[model samples]
Target: MVELLDNQRTFHIQVKHTSLVLHVLPTGHVTVIYWGKRLESKSLAYVIQDIGRASYISDTDGIKDFKLEQLPQAMPTHGNSDLRTPALVLEYADGSRITNLRYKDFKVYSGKERLPGMPTITSGEEVETVEILLEDYLQQVTVKLIFSAFYEYNAITQSVVVTNLSKSNVTIEKVVSSNIDFLDAAYDVCYLSGAWGRETHRQVRPLSQGAFLLDSKRGASGHGQNPFLALADKQANENSGSIYSMNMVYSGNFQAIAEVDMHQNTRMQMGINPFDFAWQLVPQESFYTPETVLIYSDQGYNQLSAIYHRFYRECLMKSSHAEKVRPVLINNWEATYFDFDKRKLLSLAKEAADCGIELFVLDDGWFGKRSDTTTSLGDWQPNHQKLGGSLSGLIEEIGQLGLQFGLWVEPEMVSPDSELYRAHPDWIIQVAGRDPQLARHQYVLDLANPAVQNYLITELSTLLEKENIAYIKWDMNRNITDSGSSYLAVAQQKELSHRYILGLYHVLEILTEQFPEVLFESCAGGGGRYDPGMLYYMPQTWTSDDTDAIERLPIQSGTSLIYPPISMGCHVSAVPNHQVGRITSMDTRGIVAMQGNLGYELDLTQLSTEEKLLVKEQVVQYKEIREIVQLGQLIRLTEIENQNQYAWLYRSKDATAFVVSFVQVLARANTVPKRLKLAGLDAKAYYQVGERICTGSELMSIGLKLDKPIEDYAGQRWLVKKIEK
Candidate 1:
């Protein structure tokens, strides 16, 4: 409830807790350099001061006096709980400014007092609990960065740094990824990733109107791929494990810098949206990303990717994981998209009921009177032609076949030609009489409508009651357009965007509660809808819709640099793919797919004899190492972006299992074979390779060699079945 520097140019201040709105400078800098939180009436006091104990300072290179220009503080005219964008802005001495700095790069230095009955913090005390308590340590947090930048049409290497001058070691983990809203003719998310390395990385797939880094590239390691410029090297070297990012759109800009220390266990994701810049995270050291660099782009995919690399080198940081993740997962979109009746579904269910396939999903055209992507959006009903009856009925049928049944829905959209739209014309988001705009030939539904929200909940709840539906595929295709809303008052217009997202959260929370067993996969036209906000509801996500396995190699490779493989959802689809039209080798395709939640997306009903046999063997092999792929340690043995080679590793959940994918992109003679020493093995046990057996140490020591050149860019998979004696 305090205000810092409120001016058109430079901003400076000290506060217990405050809301910020900083502007963007094109010099490649993080605008709001500081320290921060909360929702509704539930949020009261930001922080309490220790009284005469906590101090402040802006001392750094090229430092200057703090200035405050007279600026009117407009009344919100609504409850804080209703909606608000507490933005942060950064200004340079030379009259330049930028906004949107990562929360991770800021630091706080102050002593803490035990507010009677509350946990205490003291030096050398095994790190007592560190909470952003409303009554105590809120204001104690200060924003800082070793090297940062704010940019508008360009990047400038500016740096800010803050330290924990307090007596105890500050623990600052849990700054997760960001959730942002965009406003435009139609908002877009043109994203990119860094250089490719060996191993399978998920790719960024285009949504109807936006693009996102699907799969593993949504983390700090992933930021290396964002198409943004980096801070100068000397500045970036000021601290290790720091974060850098740029957020901009066709008309806006934001950037940030955060230096992370070992003592603080907090981690966060960095990125930008059209309207806002943010980082999301849980304040737990249990698991998170340490640092990252995020950027925005305007050009198509290629140009954006190059921009992402411009900022990659400066944001590099080594990443370990809470655990490895699954890479391959079977998607029903290719297998079946609103084409199956109960009997036909049952037939396909039997095909996917094998040991290799983990989950079987039914894609779009499934619910809400939706026969196609154009209608039945607000109406969440299963078309009789496809379902015959209830979704639950189909779920039960699939269960009988011993497979997990997954259903798809797009709750955030609506169609003018459908019942939901006609019933509540006001429920659609349009600029008054501006004739609702459309993307993918569809209009966006206003979840901002309580009536719309209730309908979605009612429809979703009714379906969940049918039987055990193991998974839900939440898909969103377009960005918001014609932002004016009839439902929200003028004062509450800003709330429309955030509220639309919140409304999504409310529904998801309810569904998750009603059916705790179901695993939700958020797919925003593949990755557009991807944000930490969804992760709060669904643990796993579909990385992208571009299923060309070869193009996906770089995508997945780049993705894994930041995300765990298990969390990535990849699939082996037919060559001459539906999108990219690339016909890669079946073995090469399966090899790429095996790095994820392994499953097939192509039609299995009409496979050729040899294809069927090959697929059968693959199914059997995947089943054998499923555990390792699902929850193991992932090691990228090759750098795909750097060379024509592929190599990656996954060790079992118990650390007892392991699998390695070695694809030689180009022939190499005496290229110093990379020896990936296996972990979690019983050195006590001997490992035999091929005809001749070798010690586990020997294999790790010498490794295998390819006999012929990997021409036509072909490869092989060495599945090591429990070290043979």
Candidate 2:
């Protein structure tokens, strides 16, 4: 519920257990008064009166009583006499760079609104929205600060829309999505940072006096940093204290900053990276920033994650397969790579069907003149030489074998040796005089060009129309370099990265809308572009190229902080794992991979008869409880940081079924059994675990004692069903 205190000039937005309070100062500036647990009282006049202090005294004569530097502003702008970071920066055609925005008006609505050309939370009866308008009189620019409150999820969504209102054109250098100021700086910042194989590793540090920024300047979201940032109280932990997190719903170059001012006030802002970005805004033309999610949790980090998981699954992810049970498929990437023929694929499919697999994914080398990764990327035609027949013929054969067919394509890349690149070299992103750089033997396609985007849409649509494909593994294997587009003017070269991403989103939106039946899983050389923006189009993403189960423990755990399991595409690779060369048990592999969109990535024909039987059993077991794993509430029981054990629990929405997965990284000679207390269960209910019955209270308190593993890298999965009173 949103309440406006007319007498006090304070607006309170309360959703579930959280409340955000803002007060409009006498000078028409909005200042954030409080954000955290809901307040019991209504009046915030005391908060406004207490703002005057010696530390906040401004040098100006007329405004000595009201200081912009001391005020906890909702959105700070430049040329406003504030020394802290500005949320909006604009340049006028008359060579003026000053910008000052003040409150103009506001509109409170009943339902939520979707962000244009971006992913955002869906609204229903349980959601309320408010749009506050601010205007820069000097520059004739108007900014709209939009906030959507989801009562059920206890979350708020924020974004900004800047429109050029004057007859003259204006240039926007920086426009952040959301800016929030806190009265104190007693917090620690947490973010995810890592590389390709080991993506989304968690890191935390104290919020010092200066600025702490996490950003991705690459064309994609990149592997070095994720678009998520969180601030927690200094005493916060997994189960207690206040935690606030912000996740940018953008896929391209983005920035998140946590700045502490001289008065020890904390200001957090996130949006598009302004390093090389400049938007030309003509009269009446507007720029919309992507939505940023704000979640406040007083319970701890786990509670914070649970809220995000629920929101992403129910609202952000709109793919038809988002709520459906994903098929237990087998990918041939590691098994055959680029050396698979029609006969070889059929053989693998036959073996896979025998092992109860539901789908067959023919990864790479199926299209173009492609025999290897060095050629034929942009060309999407099936190679009759490699397949020994037409693509439709092979797909029909696979369908006759009682399995669905999937194909992999890297549409955003082109090989210099291929026909597509040879025909249109200008379609690749390159500077006028500099030579184009290549990664993975490919050049990044110039998606910012409308002709290039239209060509891709046409080629991909034709293929989908002609074939009976059920799934698509869309991969981008290289990061952009020589980031200049041929079609854009020299003055607009700096807009290449953001424009490229926008173009890509347009293509994805059209394709996904047209082919609603086909499930598209995104991959950027594995996990490089795994962010909420991609999840808005595809249901899941290949978590990483590193498939080692042990290495995946930390990777998956860290990713779960912001994304749900349904959004992670995990596969059980072969023993002596191809990525890390660590030989973990098949049981452990299956257990770890089962935590996500479960599948296999090994050569089934090479396994022994006994191993094949085990594979069949594992597939059947996963099918029996895939819903619980996909749609359940995930409770992280233990982390793999300093311990040799990692564990988690999944509780069904109805609270009747649950699954617990415990993995032992290393074993000791004579170690005692460990006890794990489960979460998200009805305390008064009785649950049947295996053949034993235990009350939820007993399970959560006394906990379940786990026996020591007989060997290293062993794991166990426990299934529990609730019983009637």
Q: Which candidate achieves the best lDDT against the true structure?
A: 2
- Candidate 1, residues 122-183: lDDT per residue as tens digits? 22111111111011122233333321222221121211122233233233221222222211
TM-score of each: 0.61, 0.97
How badly does each model clash, as a count of residue pairs?
84, 0
lDDT of 2 at 662: 94
Give the poorly placed runs of model 2, Cα more than 4 Å off: 56-61
The Cα local distance difference test for each model comes to 0.46, 0.88
What TM-score does model 1 achieve against the real structure? Answer: 0.61
Every model: Cα RMSD to truth: 14.4, 1.6
lDDT of 2 by residue, 590-640 (tens): 999999988999999899999898899999999988999999888888743
